[model samples]
Target: MPVVFRFFSVFPLWLLHVMGAAMGWVVFAVSPVYRKRLVENARRAGYRFGEVRAAVGHAGRMVAELPRLWLGAPLPSRMTGEACVEQAYAAGRGIVFLTPHQGCFELSAQVAARRWSAARGPITVLYRPARQAWLASVMETARNRPGMLAVPTTLSGVRQMIKALRRGEAVGLLPDQVPPDGQGVWSPFFGRDAYTMTLAVRLAQQTGAAVVLARCERLPWGRGFVTHFEPLPVPLDERLESAVLQINQAMEHLIRQCPQQYLWGYARYKQPRAEAAAGVTE
Candidate 1:
């Protein structure tokens, strides 16, 4: 698998995207469950099938582009609304970047780390390890770069993120990803009850970090990605439930911007697994 990843890492971005789109269609055509879930999720979010149909191909492109993103030289990327980030940094508080499962989320973190880590500090990101050992190993190697620290979804990992934020550094996470049973709260996502992670809200409230919403839009023909950073639409409520709902609403706003790139096939409404005792610190 590693060898295959390295081999694909050398492919041109455009070609990879083409292959990925085809792969995405193939999966959609073959998997009845996946097709149903994808369409259902998008429709529930008030998007017509036509509006989000491109997401099928984008999903495949996401997988295909990982090798290049993880191993190849940095791709061409630019930032928009960077002033929001600058302002956050100017405040001298830490930063908590809340990105949804839209666009090239992996690339968004890479861009943040490259653009800000030297001046402020590394961006610590929370990640769940892959079940496959080989993939997990590759993921760790790819994510632990110079300006980014990838921490697992474990107690100690949470502590690491807190420490970094307390130092006025940045940390990133996907607020849309479902957390373990005990770690998340039931919140309305896209007009449906979905389990939402509260970590983002807790981190910001706990550390007084600036909560920023970020998204990376994949440019056409593999021209690379453009990452946009913006401040939250409204102040986070002090209460956890309200804050979690606010985070979900904020993610919906970001996803609406480029519904085509959002991962609609993800099982966002599924029940979460039981929390692992060893994974929680406090």
Candidate 2:
């Protein structure tokens, strides 16, 4: 699998996207379960098939671009609304970067870290290891790059994030991700009760970190990406549960901006997993 990814990494970005779009459609056609969930999730969000049909190809592009993102040359990236990040940094408190499963999310962290990690500190991101051992190994190798640190979704990892924040460093997480039992609370997302991670809120509240919402949008025809950074619509509430809901609402707003790039196929409504003895199942 790594070899295959490396081979694809050398392919032109446009060709990769084309291949990815085809891959997306093939999976959509062959896998009934994936197609069903994709359709249902889109419908639940009040989006019609016509409105979100492009998402199928977008998902494929996400996978196709990973090789280039992980092992190949860095794609050209530009940031807009960067002043928000600057302001956060100026606060001299940590930054809680909240990104949903939208656009080239992988690029979001890389962009921020490349630009700010040296001046501030490393950006520690919450990562859920793959179940497959081979994939897990590959993920670990790929994500542990300069200026970035990937921590597992465990209590220890949570502690590490908090520590980073208290030191005025940055930590990033996907608030839209469903956390394990005891790690998240059921909150309204897109008008449905989806289990949402409270870690982002907790980190901000505990350390007084500036909460920022950012997305790296994949440009057309593999041109590159436009990473946008901005502050949350409203400051996180002191109340933890309320803060979680606020982040969820912010996530909805972000996804709405580019529904076609959102991961409509993700099983976002699945029941939360029971916490293991280690208290971290991801």
Candidate 3:
């Protein structure tokens, strides 16, 4: 797998995207279950199939571009809405970056880490270890970049994020990803009840970290990506449920910005595994 990834890593970005789009359509055509979920999720969000059909290809691009992003040299990229990030940094408090499964989410953290790690500190990101041993080993090597730290989705990992935040560093999370049974609360997402992780809200509330919304937009023909940053639109409620709902609403807003790039096929509403159902930490 590593050898395959390394071989693909040398390919031109444009070619990878081209292959990826074709792969996306192939998957969409072959898998009825995947196609159904993609359409259903988009429709539930009030988007027509025609409106978000490009997401089918974008999802493939997301995977295809990883080799270049992770193993190859840095690609062309930039950040917009710098003021939001600047303002958050000026606060001298920690930062909690919340991004959904949209565009090149993998690159967003790399961009942040490269741009600000020296000035602030390494951005600690929460990630679930891949179930496959080979894939997990590859991911560990790929994600351990210079300015970022990847922690597992465990209690100890959560503690690492907290420590980073308290030290005035940054931590990134996909708040829309369903958490383990005991780690999340049921909340409304896009007018539907989805189990949402409360860690993003809790981190901010506990350590006074600034909550920044981030989205990485994939440019056409693999021109590279642009990560946009903004402060959370609304104040978080004092109540946990209300705050989780607010976070979900914020994610909805981000996804709406470029619905075509969002991964509408993800099993966002699926029940979490039962293994972590006991003694879950906040």
Q: Which one wins on lDDT?
A: 1
Estimate the Cα RMSD of every predicted model relative to the unseen true structure: 1.3, 2.2, 1.3
Q: What residue runs in model 3 are displaced by over 4 Å at the alpha carbon?
A: 277-282
Over the stretch 53-164, how does candidate 3's per-residue lDDT look in tens digits?
9999998998898888889989789999878888888889899999999999989999999999999999999899999998899888888899999999887888899889
Query: What value of lDDT does candidate 2 attain over all alpha carbons?
Result: 0.89
lDDT of each: 0.93, 0.89, 0.91
Residue-by-residue lDDT tens digits, candidate 1, 1-282: 999999999999999999999999999999999999999999999888898999999999999999999999898999999898899889898999999998899999999999999999899998999999999999999999999999999988999998998899999999999898888889999999999888888889888899999999999899999999999988899999999999999999999999999999999999999976323233
Q: Any residue pairs clashing in model 3, and if so which?
A: none
Q: What local lDDT does model 2 show for residue 148?
A: 95
Better of 2 and 3 by TM-score: 3
Please list the residue runs of candidate 1 whose C-alpha ends up more than 4 Å from where it truly belongs after superposition. 277-282
Question: Native-vs-model 1 lDDT?
Answer: 0.93
Q: Write the per-residue lDDT of candidate 2 for residues 136-247, one digit (tens) a residue.
A: 8888888889999999987788888888988899999988887877778889998999988877787888788899999889998989999988899888888878989999
TM-score result, candidate 2: 0.96
Deviation from truth (RMSD, Å), model 2: 2.2
